[model samples]
Target: MFPWGDSDSELIEVQGPRAAIAKPKSFHAHGVHFWEIGSDKRLAGAILHHCRSGIGKLRACTGGDQLALFKIGITHDYDSRFDLYRSHGWEKMLVLFYSSDLGQVEMLAPAKHVAAIAAAFAKTSSDGALSAIARCPQNDAERAMQKALCKFDLTLDAPVTYVNVGEQCLVPCLKPTDYVRTLNERGYLHRLIGCPIDSSAGALSEFWARLSKAEPQLEVCQDLADGLVDPRTLIPVYIHGDGGRTYKHDELMIFQFQPCMGHGTMHSRPVKPNSIGVSLKGHSFTTRFLFGVLQKAIYSNDPSTFERFLEHMALDLQSLYHVGVKHERTGVVFKFCVIGVKGDLPFLAKAGNMNRTFLHIRKRPFLPHSPEDPPSFFKLDVLHLYHLGVGRDFGASSLVYLMTLYEAESIPKAIEKLNSDFKSFLLSSKKVVHFKQITKDLLGYISSKAYPVGHWNKAMDTPVVVQFAEWLVEKFGGESTPDLLIRSGCKAIGVCMRTMLSSALWLDRSEAKIVGDAALHFAQCYGKLVHYFSRKVSACTIWCQNYIFGTISH
Candidate 1:
């Protein structure tokens, strides 16, 4: 991808992630060569590295919003400069944020560029022989840095901005109402406002149909998707929260708003989402942006220090639900409830502070929400529950069964041979497998608490096992040898998995019904195979069927 502007300009070819280690290449920035900026190449090189990252990390409170600190100043021997600060007793220096071009920072083109540089780079040091052209002493350089920051009136001090709680690591943000105001003022809502909203369930697309059926108190987006009522600017909203980390306990949670409406997933779309709030409880800050989407607002939340983030977030959501916020300038009434939430089970439970097993029928968490009769939210995550859980179980267990046919002296020997074939098959198909070796432990074959299921920790390697199973059946299937039922089951389930994950946007009733019946053929075959091995098969849970029928029926 090209930079934001001027694609014709000279560009640096940075190494892609596939490389073992990328060799740094010299480059220029803002019309100045980085290597030529200073005399000491070591210090100059450090600046280049830190420009991509941070130098020293500290905290600052700007307008009562706690933020990651950046000290822009001229310095020599950058290491010693930070050491003095540490000796004087400050929060332990973590990562670094330093820049020598303090006074000259204002010369940057856009005000936004100024803020972005300060967020990432902006270092300080007492002694540097040569630095950003005309480098000065520490104290004077810091004053220049502070002056530049103040001149822009950034740091979320603008009236429309909010405190940062590491909220999406936004370089700059706007308050929630201001965010809506900006969008509305810019005419992003032009087509949406006062537009005819489809409330009829039959006329609705899958997105709205499923939503309306799930709650059914009122039509799906009427509370947010309408502007027909005079003097109102309704903004339909979908709040999505996510875990910061995967394959382990999440470090923190992130919430963003993706303004969505219209018929189906593909019939229409909205601008990308932005951050509204974040939780940063003394953990080191994270700088990863979500798909490079610009975040609008930050509500600093740390469970210990900034404990009221969630409370404030709920209050803000409630305000949106109740009287709809008025645009500061336009005075348009923008009303929208969080008509829907899109997130995985873990993130949903954590954000709502509900029981981990949310589908177990418990007291409702919100004011107007009551437990569904069969939990409409049980829509199967085809990737996880199927590809990662049950499908993976069948795949690995089937592989283990194939291993037994090898008649190796030990289970380990059987496993080794099976994995060799598995790896070769996946490699031939140009798929990468993360696991070094597959073992009985990973398949949970030794466990009595549950059936022989795949309990692999890394969720990413799921596809390899899945493809391997399908390949094994394809390569070894015969009515006289391999179980014909199991072989068919593999092919059927693979087809169903691919169908469920299809990118197709719209579907007719017959097509939906066919896809709904698709998984059943394999599930039936799988059950028979399970019974053949275990002598009994547990009934498929109602929720899975409910999801299949409810969604298809929708």
Candidate 2:
């Protein structure tokens, strides 16, 4: 009996969980069998077995939409790869082959045979035979395949038929005569007018002056006379597109403003109510601009620039009351709210800056810091702390320094010895194992040497801590004697770490807390060094704690 059983070919029964007991299977309906062969060799073997058993000759083979009763063969050796298939006559068979670990199906039929196959399949199905091709190549490969098929001119004698197949059918219709009138009545559409200009600093200043003269009610500031500065010259400022809108009927318009010195360009979009536009241009009297300049000065480590920036910032905020009162008189409301500020330690700690800003305000007799006030004052970037303070400065630099002390050849030899020991232990155990299991067992064995080091309170006396401190002293000499070169390396590490770890939203809060605690302990133990390594590490720990308990908690 055949594998499918000697039933009528049109009504053969399929054997599976979903098979019906009362009804016979239809001629067109068949169950698909899927096999996941482990390797190319196994796939080749399976193909050869199918051919030898005459399964390929008996079963119908499908390539794209074309079906044929064709012989299939798997090439066993490279010498007979193409020659064997070619000798068998291309029209008589389809070849099963493997290349670069992927299974490929190739047609051996000539153009005439391909054309006949395409035409016959097209007549039997609504979708053309070409559409039936499984895992069709795309782009250039698709175009090449089409070009090859076109050579055969696979035209059908019958008209092409299409089945609905649940696809939506769109019907064309004419709009009602009153559609425009109905839209007008609803007031759903508005006309927009746009004007494009060169928008250089001089042009922007002139435009602002003309606008201010035309609409004195808008109360455009006197600062507009100087024109807008290039945005690229300063740290980027981005406002959400949806923000700063107070009215639904507000028009959306963007004015391109180029800087005077040809530095870079910026855009100005007018806010609602007064049509007063603001660009990311800084002035000597604006707090926002002063703050930006302060940041640049801090980053560049310029003391003169830092002082100058602070002086300008102070002058800007001096007329704060008058500016507010003036805008109120003109029916224009000016609002300023400082959200949390993020910066590295040096920047935030500068005199009359983050630290002193809060202190001065708190000391005032009239206005005092209150618990009800929002905590949007100053924030340290947690990433800067972890990467710059802990990972780069301490962990990575220490590891690199330790590596430098050992001979290059000795390190590889040590690793080889460890690997050999691990493999020997695995072999002696005689248990079924996988990559993960071996790794777990190896790490478990190695960690035994570093275990029993109690909590942070006992960290000072911990064997690991003692050993590391001793090693540090022995490797680099007395604590008082500073290695400027190695210290510079630590600083470089801190800089890199800050850059890499600046974003912490992706990390689990608990994980961040744990790392922060570890860093704190590290700083407390080793921070007394004159090189200030501990101070940097402590900064990261503090930042982490602040982030977890403050930002995330709120």
Candidate 3:
């Protein structure tokens, strides 16, 4: 008997809510619209094919010529070897046909691809593959399977069909629609998981819950609040420690899981691992507390808040130092340390380490003092070093030529002159001027054809070299002093001028030698200054040896 009834009209209004809604109409508004798009023809063919053969392909005509070739269908031929297996045999495959252009058409394979069809019937009693395929496409595939079973009396001996073990009768444990509705209402289903419910929910839920609970809580120190410290202060002290602090008594025992199969033994043994012992000393609680606060501030995502927190922490440490001094004990010292990778050391040394307040602490006692030596207490963080040192240096260097031209004595004055000059230049001319307009103009002039390249290339042009040397001396004041070299603006200008002169082939051997000697003298003086500052700051603080890690063990 024909499962879709004897006549075409009866098939169109087949018994079932889906068929009732999906069925075509002849005299309705939506019917008229569907008719205009030839949905009647496609629907009729789909119904007829599905009723007779239990499988059908339906192609909608509403998406223009581009979508005319697109189709949705079911095929038993997808797994031809299914009959050879004892498990669910002759599995049906849902296929979606798509075409980029009229000439090329291809099927949208299952999410698991060919493997899903190949593994349709597992060797074990459980038909996992068939269950997986059924669960994959909740709407289309499930509806098509129901139609197939009703029309052709098809039997799928899948895991979902088994009510209990040894039962041959087909029965679903839970309807897919009911299960999906239940999961959605329970808040377990969402777009992020990409399905109504995850297959491994039973195993993963407990672990996920534990992980959430185990997550660490981060809190900021109330003592290190804003309005406590001066942002412009030369030294920012964010840590404090006493020289006599210790952490050796607090030993941690660790264990590892070992496999049973091992040489000379039937059972695995718990072996003691090699370890590096660290001793903690000096204001451990204070250092840890401040570090925690700093960490929280850094991760807060508010720069203004972070800056305020940093300033307050610095002032708090400074206050602590004063308190220690009043008690005749070791005071908290403001030793600024900036650590970074080798490439970053140069810029960091020039930026943070160049300050007159702090000194670079040497790693090895035998090693000669060098400008590249990093700060004493703090290890260099790449983010902080890049943003504060290298990044800021680039911006500062861009204004060096303009600052030199204006001959500003300080950074603030140079910035003021730059802004004013830029504004005036913009008001008078159509050309836009930036903060580093003078530097760009100087670079352009030097690179231009009118610039004397020959004079720079020759060794006899002592006048050009002398002219640059005199300019440097005048701007820096005392060319031989490290204090002069340590000034960021002077260093920037010297580096910029040296680069331009070298690039122009203007720096002869004698001129290069003079610049080189002056740079060396600056380095020597800078190293001495760093050491001197270190000694001076050590008097206020405990001056305990610090580890790069949070622990400061004596």
lDDT for each of the candidates? 0.43, 0.30, 0.29
Higher-lDDT candidate of 1 and 2: 1
TM-score of 2: 0.22
TM-score of each: 0.48, 0.22, 0.16
Prediction RMSDs, each to the true structure: 16.5, 26.0, 28.9
Q: Number of clashing pairs, model 2?
A: 6
How does model 2 fare in lDDT? 0.30
Worst 10 residues of 1 by lDDT: 275-284
What tens-digit string does per-residue lDDT give for candidate 3 at 63-142? 43444332233333323322233154322222222122322212222233323343454333365444444443322344
In candidate 1, what are the lDDT values of residues 1-554, reduced to their tens digit? Answer: 01111332222222221222222353322111111122222232233344432222112112222454334453433345555765665333222222344433323223233333444443553322212312322323433444554554422231333444453442323334444444445443322221222221222233344444546553323432353322124444545554454222424455455444432222223212221111111111111112111212222243321223333344444555456655444555656544444455554544454322222222222223334433333333344556555666666666666675667998788788887887788779988766667888887777332456677756556656766766776676545323666677777766664543332333347646666676787777665566555533244333233432343221
Tally clashes: model 1. 17
lDDT of 2 by residue, 210-323 (tens): 434643332122223333322111111111111011123332211111111111113222222212222322331221111221123132444444434333333333222123
- In candidate 3, stretches whose alpha carbon ends up further than 4 angstroms from where it belongs are 1-383, 386-414, 420-554
Q: What C-alpha lDDT does candidate 3 achieve relative to the native structure?
A: 0.29
For each candidate, how many residue pairs have backbone atoms clashing (under 3 Å)? 17, 6, 10
